[model samples]
Every structure is written in C-alpha cells, then in structure tokens.
Target chain A: MKILVCISNVPDTTTKVKFTDNNTKFDANGVQWVINPWDELALTRALELKDNAANGITAVSVIHVGNASSEPTIRKALAIGADDAYRVNAEPTDAYNVAGQISEIVKSEKFDIVFCGIESSDFNGSTVGSMVAEFLDYPSVSAVSGLNIENGQTVITREIDGGKEVVSVPAPFVAIVQKGIAKEPRIAAMRGIMQARTKAIKVSEPVAIDSLTEIVTFELPQPRAKCKMVDAENPKQLIELLMNEAKVI
Target chain B: MSVLVFTENWDGKFKKSSFELASYATKVAEMLGTTATAVSIGNVDDSELKSLGNYGVKKVMCVKNDSLNVHDSQTYTKVIAEAAQKEGAKVIIIANNNTGKALAPRLSVRLKAAIGSGVNKLPLSVNPFVVVKRAYSGNAYAQVALKSDIKIITLAQNSFELIETPNDAAVEAFAPSIDASMVKTQLKDVQKQSGKILITDAEIVVSGGRGMKSADNWAPLSELANLLGAATACSRPVSDEGWRPHDEHTGQTGKIIAPNLYIAIGISGATQHIAGVSSSKFIVAINSDKDAPIFEAAQYGIVGDAAKVLPQLVEAVKELKGK
Candidate 1:
C-alpha cells in the first residue's frame, strides 16, 4: 500500500500575521515558516500507518504545492519519515486551484491512500481535500479522527454533529484529517536528518489553473474591549455579574 | 438574476449557519435590486422549506433524493452548480461550516467563480466587490476581492444575525442530474449526539481546559453548563488527554464555533484555540494564571483555580436562576 500526504508551509502559529504590497500579499519578513500544524498531524498519522507492519505499507510520500522557498518545509516532512517528496512548484492561489493541481498528481500516481490537512493554516480554506476528492471522483471523508487500515480496507471514525460516524472504504480514497490524528508529531532524529538530506525531492510543474479570489486589503480585528476583571476570591460576585450584568446565566 | 443562497439542509430544516446565510443573501439581494433564492437538498418537508420565507428569501428550490442524502462534495457541487446556472445568479452565498467547507471549493471550480470563505461583513463596494474575512485564526481581517463575474461567498457563523424580514416565499422542486455512480462511499452508521444541544448550535457554551485537572473534575463545569442550558467544550489538551470527547475540542484544527457567550475555564487561550471562539459575541475566561492569553480575547476574566471558582459560580447561578 502506498500513502500520499499533502503538506502546506505556513507561518508558525506564534508569528504575528501581516500583509504587505498594499495588503495584496503576506508580509514574510521575520516570519518563521514551518510545516502547517494540521498537515503535520496528518503526516504523523500517515507515518504511523506506514510504520505498522500489519498495514503492509510500502512507500509514504509527502507532496506540496509551493515554490522553491518551500523546499526546506518539504525536507522537514522527509525527515519525519516520508519515503520521498514531490513539490508541485506553484503558489496555491486558492483552494480550487490547489485541489485541481493535487488531483493531477493523485490521478497520475497510483497511491492507495491520499491524506491532506483538514485545512491550510494560512488561508484556513478547509476545502482542498474534499475538493481534490471531487476532482479525482474518489471516495472522500473529512475531519476523521481515528483511522485503521486492515485487509486492504481503511475504516475511519469521524465526529459528527452530535456523535461519531464510522465509515469503511477500500484503498484509493482521500482523507482530510484534523487534530488528534496523532498524539504528538514525531520530531526528526539526527540520523533521519542525514537521511533526508540525500532523499530525492522531485520538483514538478503545476497544472494550469486560474485563481479566483484575491486579497484587496488587510486589517486587524477591532481591539478587544477592556476585560472586566473581578475578584477571583469572590465567586458570588462573579455569578452576580454573569446574571444581572453579562446576562449569560 | 437572483442572489442564490445554498442552505445545506439536513433531515428537514436548514442548519443554523445556512439559515443565517439565507437571511444574509436576502439582505444582499435587496441591496442589489434582485430577489433572494435559497437552494437546498435532502429529504425536506414542504412547510420546513417554506419557513425560509421568514428569513426573507423570496423563493426556495429544493432537490429531493436519497442518493444525495449523504455528504458528497462532488454531488453537492454538481447540484448547486446546476441551480446557479438555472437561476442566473451572480452572487452565491453559503455558510462557512462543514457542508460549505466541502462543497464551495468544488462548486467554485465547477462554475469558475471567485470564492471567499470565512467572509464576515457585507460587500464594501459593488463596482469592484470587496468582502471582509478573518485570517490568522481570528486576530485579523482581510478584504477579499471577487474578480470573477460569479462571486461565491461562505459567510462565517455569527457574522450576520438572522433577523426576520418576512416574505411570502415559494418552494419549487428541483432534481439535479444524479447517477448511481454518485454514491462513491457509503456511511455504515452514525452515532450522533442526542438529547443535549450540540456546541455548533448552542447560543451559550461553557468550555474547560487542562485547568479543569481531570475528566472527573468536569462535573462542576458541566453543572454550570446545564444550569445555563449551554453546551460543553474543551481545549485541545483536554481532548488530547482523553479528558473530554473529541467532538468537544474547539480550536483551529478542531471545531470553530461562535456562540453568544463562551465561558472558558482553565484554558490558557492558545492562538489556535482562540480562533475557534474569537467570533463569539462575549468571552469569559477563568484561570489560575492571570497572564493566560485567553484573557486578552475574553470580555470578562477571573484569575483563580477552576476547581474553587467553578463550584462557587455554579452555586451563584443556581441561586440567581432560583433553581
């Protein structure tokens, strides 16, 4: 079985996001780039499935749609135990185009399982995995928390509106995974780092697609109103404020 | 041409966010000097479909079929794309929820329309349309430009209040091209939450985090939630440690929610977690650490041990509500 995991390079969660070029582009200065946390979670799950001997997984590959600047991010995925890497050198203009490009590679390659983050951290589109599934005309499940692969069938458990839904599908389906896919993402060991340096990163041209939405300007949310801090020692006062003042209770 | 709103309906009624989108679409339509039409799918009752009139939609077009019952992005995109073509809609609206997350991107690709997800405010200028959207979780906003003639928007929950405009809405039956091949995957079974209100639909939420100490300690917080008729949620760490159900995890990668009142207990307010509830109308944080980042987003805060604070607050609420 072969697994394909898609990763997005995004600014670290701690970074203060700012837009430049008259708010048309993201300001990259002093921003620390890292593997999108959501995608890293997916990668962790993909690696776990690949490592389990019973799954009979052969290759676990990571794919990205970004230009040269994202190479380091792809290498990081390789260090995290991806067998190989592929970069569709292009800007992910929008979720539609991103899904379109991913469908191109997934169709050409015969991977048994395709995994992507539920959404990219930067745009938070939450659209690519399902869109790619639609583009590929493949069975797709979104926001799955638990996955088990056995006997050529993958069973996924996803949280629904009120409860859990369990669905089983054969190989060759797209899974858009969210947090808790793995407890903790595995960090690269020195040995793994050395191995990743030699692993091949195949850079491929992107499928042609037009971007739909464009950023016109960027602004900060209105500053939060000053918080009313009450005496923690007095819980009765807290309750009073919640009722008569806040009207929450 | 009309402003088309895709109400991702379920059993019989439209979801809360989709209902909000329907109301938003009507207001937008009135501004653009056109009518608002709501497009929906699944097994829906005639009266339930007609109730959209209360939200100001002029017409409702519903596609009924068993095969389209399950959440299929491909089929949903096809269904909505067909509706957009039929109505000659220039602006399409949807909710930035699970259904919209799956359908909008594929629909945009199918219709070659400009797509904006997490949209909040109305269009600033009509000539070159610009819509406000949240970014970096919820710390900032960006004005997105829709360059295409067919502009699609997925509005964030709580962004627009669903006020009754009162219109005599008409329901029309629609049947999109659905083949057997459309059912790519089958849902074996669903164990949905019953009896209790879901956090996604709750107006008030009381959430606990690692500060709650353990799963057993969730009792007091749960009591407070029950007293207020609110839903319960947890921070990522609490869910990761099995202190809470995965469905109750509210964070960037988990569930993004926007209730009227979000009471966060024991959470330090991580950036990703804040993104989930930042759109909330009011936030109240309780933590032992005064410097917890959650206080920044919270409208009210209490620096104390949740174990001590929760019971007292619960007692106070019980007294106020005269329970």
Candidate 2:
C-alpha cells in the first residue's frame, strides 16, 4: 500500500506575520519556511508505518501544491524519508484550487491513502482535505488522532465533542490528522539529508482552476493594552480586579 | 433566497455554539433582507428544535436520520446540501467546530459554494459576500471575498454574541435522500472523557507551562480550575515533556481555542503559543518573569512564581465563590 501525504510550505511558527501590497498579500521577505507542523507529523506517521514491514506499507510519497520556491520544503520532506515527492507548479491561491490540484495528482497516482493536516498555520482554512475527498469521491475521516493498520484493516481514532471514537475505514481514503498522530516529527539524519539531494522531485503543472474565494485584505489584531500588574503578596487584589474591573470572573 | 444555519445537537440538545450560529445567521439574513432557517440533524425533538427560535430562527428543518446519529461527513454534507437546495439558501452558516471543519469543504464542493472557514464576523458586504476571519494563526486577520453565487461560512465559536430574539419558529421535518454507499466508515467504539471539562467547550481555561516546575505542581492549578469551573491546559513543552497529556496542550500545533477568560500560569508565551490563544477575550498571566511575552498579551498579570501564587489564587477563588 502506498501513502501520499499532502504538505504545505508555511512561514515558521515563530516568524512575525506581516502584510504587503497595502495588506493584501503576506510579506514573505526574510521569512523562514517550514513544512506545516501537522503535515510533518502526518509524514512522520506514514514513514513509521512504512518502517514496519508487517504493515505492508510499500512506499510513502509527499506532495505539495506550490511554486518552485517551495521545493526546499518538499526536499525536506524527502530527507525525512518519503520515497519520492511531487510539487504542483502553482501558487496555492485558495483551498479550492489547491484541493483541485491535489485531486488531479491523486487521480493519476492511485495511492491507497492520502493524508492532509487538519489545517495549515497560515491560512488556517481547514478545507483542503475534505474537499480533496469530495473531488475524489473517497471516504474521509477528520480529527484523526490515531491511525493503525490492524489485521490489514485501517483503524482510525478521531476526537469528537466530549471524547473520542474509533472507526475502521476502507482503503483509498483521506485522513485529516491533528496532533498525536505521531509522538513527534522525526529529524532527518545526516545520511538521509545527503541522499535527499539525489531523490526525484517530479514537477507537475497545476490543473486549470479558479479559486472560489479571494483575499480582500489582511489586518493585524489591535495591539494589546499594557498589562495591569497586581503584586504577588496581594493575590486577593487580583481576584477582586478580575471580578470588578475585568468582570471576567 | 434565505439564510440557512446548520445547528448541531449533542444527544438532542443544542449547545451555545448552535444558538450562536442561529443568531449570526439571523443577523446576516437581516443584512440581506431575508429570514434565517435552521437545519438540525439527529434526534432533536420538536420542542428542542423550536427553542432555536429564541435566537431569531424563524424556521427549523429537523432531519432525524438513524444513519446520521453519528457524524459521517459525506452523508452530513449530502443532507445539508439537499436542505440548502430546498430552501434556496444563498448563504449557509455552520459552527467552526470539529463537525463543521470536516463537513464545510465537502459541502462547498457539493453545493458549488465558496467557503469562508472560521469567519468571525458578518459579511463586510452582502453583494460581494466578503467575510473576515483570523489568519496566520491569530497573528493576523484576512477579509475573504466569496465569488460564488452560494456562500458557506463556518462561524468561529465565541466570536459572535447570542441575541435572544424569540419568534416561535416553525419546526418542519426534513428527509433528505441518503445513499447507503455514503456510509463508508464503520464506527467501532466511542470513548468520552468524563468529569473533566473539555478545553474546547470551556468558557474559561487555566493553563500551565514549563514554569509550573513539575507535574506534581499541577494540583493547585487543577484546584483553581475546579474552583472556577474552567478547563485545565498546558503549553506544548509541558505536554512534550510528558508533564501533561497531549490533549491538554494548547498551542499553534495543539488546540486553537477562544475562551472568555484564559489564565496562563507560568507560560512565557512563545509566538506559537500566543498564536493559539490570542483569540481569548481576556488573558491573565502569572509568571515570575515580569518581562515574559505572555504579559504583553495579557489584560492582567502578576509577576511572581507560579508556586507562590497559585495556591493563593485558588484560595481567593474559593473565597470569592463563598466555598
């Protein structure tokens, strides 16, 4: 069985967000890029499943819907141990367009399972995975925290309102995973990084599609007011402030 | 022609989020000179359905499908899309919760609608259908313009206020055709976390971090949480170090919550951690380092060791509650 993990190139979690072009576009200047944290975890889980020969997972491949500038992120996925990678040559305009591009790749690849992070840290749209499943007419399980192949059947654990539910899904499905899919993302070993330079990163042109939504502008949240400090010795004063001043208690 | 809101019921009872969605949809409908209709799936009774009227819903479509007792995104999408078609709903609103997160994108595809996920406000313009939502985590906001004829919006929880506008809404039964093949996944078991409040649903959260010192120090934090009826959370490092469960981790990579009151104890407020929680209506920080970044985002702060202050705070809460 082959697994395809969809990864996105996003600004590092610590990078201060800025807007350009009158706040219509994200400023990418001097921003560090990394594989989306969730996608990295998904890829790590896929690789772990592949590591165990008993799981019958033959190969794990990574795919991204981005321009050439994101190839470094894609190569980083390769270093983390994907067999190969696919980079759709297009700017990820919106969730719909990105999902359509991914669906095109899934149609040709015929992977048994596809993984997408629940949401990217940038757009936080949380739409692409299920949209891809809808486009492919495949079953999708979201909020997946645990995925295991038991007796050749895929067992999935998803978090719901109060608790969690475990389910079994048939193959060729989408798993929209969140945290706990893997203990932690694996760091690429030196040898793996060396080998990643030689691995094949197939570039495919994006399928023609129009984004359903457009970004009108970007605005930063208003700066927070200076914090009102209460002395540690007078902890009760803090409580009174919460009740009377903040009225949040 | 009308605004449709998908209200999710837990064991046949609607939560605050459902009512908030109803209220939001009503306001949006008012903006567009139309009425708001709500669609409920699962075992909600007529009286319970009519209660949505308290939030300005004029009509409710109740779909009592046994197959949909548990959420299957595919079937739920199909059922909601059919309801939207029947109502000629130009705008569809859903809560940006787990169910909505899973269902909205598929509905967007099925209904050929543009989705504005996690939208925090009403349409900036009704003609163009633009909505504002948090982007780049909570560090920035984006105004999204929907170009499609039909628009689907996932309302961020706690972002909108629930206005009680009683209208005595009419509850009508809705039966959408469900294909058996749509049930692809078999639910084997369910495990509900009991007793403790879920952070996502909690109005207030009391979170700890590495500065809490050790797992043993969580008792006072838990006591404060219990006193205030708040959920307990931890920073990513605390969870990573196994001092707290991964489920309790709240950061950019963990749960993104917007509670009414977030009391962050000992958390230095990394950019990522702040990203997850900056949506909180009010933040109170307690840390030894006065210069911790958390104080910058907090409304109120105490510059002291969490160990020295936590017990006192807990006692103060108990006294305030007359315990």
Candidate 3:
C-alpha cells in the first residue's frame, strides 16, 4: 500500500505572533518555524504503519503546498521517514486553492491512502482535507483518532461531540487524523537526518485556482488583565475574588 | 438575494448554539438589507425548525432524507449548496462548531465562494465583506476579506448572542436533485451519550494538565467540578499519557472551548491548549509554577500544588454556595 502525508510549515507554538505591513501580514522575522504538530502526528502514524508492515505498506511520500522557503520544513518531514517529497510551489492563499493543488497532483500520482492533520496550526481552517476529498471525488473521514485498513477496505474511529463514532469505508480514501493515531511522534535520528539532506525535493508548478479569501489585516488579542495573585496560605481569598471581583460564581 | 442560515439539530433536539447562529444570521441579513431564511437538516422535527422564527427566521426550508439522519459532510454540503442556489442567497451563515468545520470547506469549494471560517463577530464592513477571526491560537486576530459575491461565514460559538424576534417562520419542504452516487458515506455506528453537560455548553470547566502528576490525582479536579456544576477537561499531555479520557482533552487538536469560567489546574498553558480556552469569559489558573503561561491569560491565579489546592477550592465554593 502506498501512503501520502500532507505537511504544513507553521510557527512554533511558543512564538509570539505579530503582524507587519500595517497589520496586514504575518511577521515571520524572529519566528521559529516547525512542522505543524498535527501534521507531525500524521507523518508519524504513517511511518508506524510502514514499520509494522501493515497492509503491505511499501512507500510513504510527503507533499507540501508552499514556496521554496518551506524546503526546510519539508526536509524535516523527509527525515521522519517519508520516502519522497513534492513541494507544490504556491502561496496557498486559501483552503480551496490548497485542495485544488493536491487534487491536481493526485490525478497523476495515485496513492492508496491520503493522510493530513485535521487542521493547519496557522489558519486552523480544518477544511482542506475534506475539500481535497471532494476535488478528488474520494470518500473522506474527519478527525479520525483510530484507523485500520485491510485489503482495500477501511474502518475508522472518530470523535463526535459527546462520544466516538466508528465508520467503515473502502480503500483509496482520505483520513484527517488527530492525537490517538499515534502516541508520540518519532524524532529524527542521525542516519535519517543524513539521508534527508540528500533526498530530492521535487518542486512542481502550482495549478492556478482562484482564491476566494484573503487576510486583509491582523491585530493582536487585547491584553489580558494582570493576574490577581491570591495567597496560597489563604485559599479562601481566591474564592472571594471569583465571587466579588470576577462575579463568575 | 436572501441570507441563508443552516440551523443544525443534534440527535432529535436543536442545540442552543444553532439558535444563536440563526439569530446571528438574521442580524447579518439585516446588515445586508435582506430576509433571513433557514434550512433544517438531520432528524429534527418540523416544529423545532419552525421555532427558529423566534430567532428571526422568516422562512424555513426542510431537507429530509432517511439516509441523512447521520451527519455526512459531503451530502450536507450538496444540500446546503442547493438550498443557497434555490434561494439566491448572497450570504450563507453556519455554526463554526464541529459540524460547520466539516461541511463549510467542502461547500466553499463546491460553490466557488470565499469563506470566513471561525469568525468572531459580524462583518466589520459589508462593502468588501470583512470579518474578524481568531488567529495564532487566539493570541491574535485577523481581518478576513471575501471578494466573492456569494460569501460563507461560520460564526464562532459563545461570541454571538441569541436574539428572539418572533415572526412565525413558515416551513416548506425543498428537494435538491440528489443521486444515489451523491451519498458517498454512511454512519455505521454512533456512541453519543451525555450525562453531564457537554464542554461546549458548559458554563464552567475545570481542566487538569500534566501537572496533576498521576491519573489518580484527577479525583480532586472532578470533585471540584462536581461541586461547582462544571465539566472536567484536561491538557493534551494528560490525555495523551492515558491519564484522562480523550473526550476530555481540550487543546488545539482537541476541543476548542469557550465557557464563561475556565479553571486550569496543573496546566502549563501551551499555546495549543490556550488557543482552545482563550476566548473564555473568565480564566483562573492553579499551578505551583508562578511563571506558567496560564497565568498570562488568567485573570486570577494561585501558586500552589493542585493536589493540595483543589480540595480547598472545592470546599470554599461549596461554602460560598451554601451547599
């Protein structure tokens, strides 16, 4: 079975977000870039399936829809055990454009299964995976926590609001995955890092799809009020503040 | 052109958020100088769909199919797209909840419409159609512009108030051309059962992170939640380590919650976790680390061990409530 994992480059969780160009663009000056946490989990899960010889998994390839600047982030994914890489050169202006690019590529390179993090950390749109499935005319599942595929058929478990829902589908489908798919993401080893340095990153021209949305401006969240520290010894003071000052009780 | 609202119903009952979304959509319709229409999907009763008139819906369209009882994002997308086309809708508003997350993107692509998902408020300017959205895990905000004539906006939960202006909304059955191949997926099994309030609806939430130290230490947090009539949640690590149930996990990959009061115990407040709860009306953090990131977002904080502090906090709340 061949697997495809979609990767996104996002600012580290600790980075302080700022907007430049008169508050109209994401300022990437001092921000540290890393693979999105959700995508990392997706890649790790694919590797685990490959390691265990699940479904005769032969190869795991990675894809990213961004310009050459995202090469480092793609390299990190390759280091995590992706067999090949493709960087669709584009700005990824919106989820629709991103899905269109992937779908265009999928028509040429057919894979048995496709995996992507449920949402991107930067935009948190949570729509790209399903849109890709629609563009490819493939059945897709969202926020799948557990997955099992066998002989061209798949059964997946996903979380509903209050409980879990288990569903069955045929192969050649998309699964947007989250936490329970893998306990811990695998770290790159020395040998894998060396291999990734020489791995060929194929840059494919982006297919033009009209982007419907744009970020016109950006603003930081309003500064939170300073914390009112309560004496640990006098625990009742905390309750009093919640009652009188905050009035949440 | 009219404004179309997708008023979703869960199970057999309508969610309060759906009503709030309907009201929000009505306001958007007023902003656009048009009428607000609603489409009710799933196993909802016709009476409940009509009740949206109380939320300012003027006309309601009912889409019924035995196969639609289970939520299929693809089919729902087709249904909503057809409804929007039938009504000549210029603006389509949906709930930015789980269902919206699933259906909105596909609909956006299908209709070739620009979308503003997870919008915090009404349009800032309707001419170009700009809306404010949460960015970078709620630490920042972004103004989005949708240039398309047909626009879709998914309003954030708890951000918009549910306003009632009874108009006796009329319900009519509408059929969208659908083929057997259109329904590509089906729900094999569903295990939804709720005893306590769902986190999305809870006014108060007591969330524990890895600082709780062990799975056994969760009792105090649960006890405190019980005392205050709140739900229990946890950080990603707590759930990842199998210390807490996965459903209780609240973070970036987990549930994004916006309760009235959110209390964090033992959580260090990673950006991922904070993104989910930052929109909460009030925040209080109880952690031994005085410099934990939770304190930055919290209005009140205590530097004490969660195990030692949870019980006392519970007792104090009970006493204050005269329970």
Q: Estimate the TM-score of every prediction.
A: 0.95, 0.98, 0.95
The DockQ for candidate 3, computed on C-alphas, is: 0.69
Clashing pairs in 2: none
Off by over 4 Å in 1: A169-171, A244-249
List candidate 2 stretches off by more than 4 Å. Answer: none
Q: What tens-digit string does per-residue lDDT give for candidate 1 at A25-73?
A: 8889998899998889888998898888898899999889889999999
Q: Write the per-residue lDDT of candidate 3 for residues A89-205, one digit (tens) a residue.
A: 998888888989988877788987899898777887777887888788677778688877656457788877788898876667888888788878889998999999998888899
- Docking quality of model 3: it rates as medium
Question: Which tens-of-lDDT digit does each residue in B92-153 have in candidate 2?
Answer: 99999999999999999887799999998888998888999989999999999999999999
Clashes of 1: 3
DockQ of each: 0.65, 0.87, 0.69
What stretches of model 3 exceed 4 Å from their correct place? none
- Sort by TM-score, best first: what order? 2, 3, 1
What lDDT score is found at residue A233 in candidate 1? Answer: 82
Candidate number of the best lDDT: 2
In order, the Cα lDDT scores of the candidates are 0.84, 0.93, 0.85
Clash-forming residue pairs, model 3: none
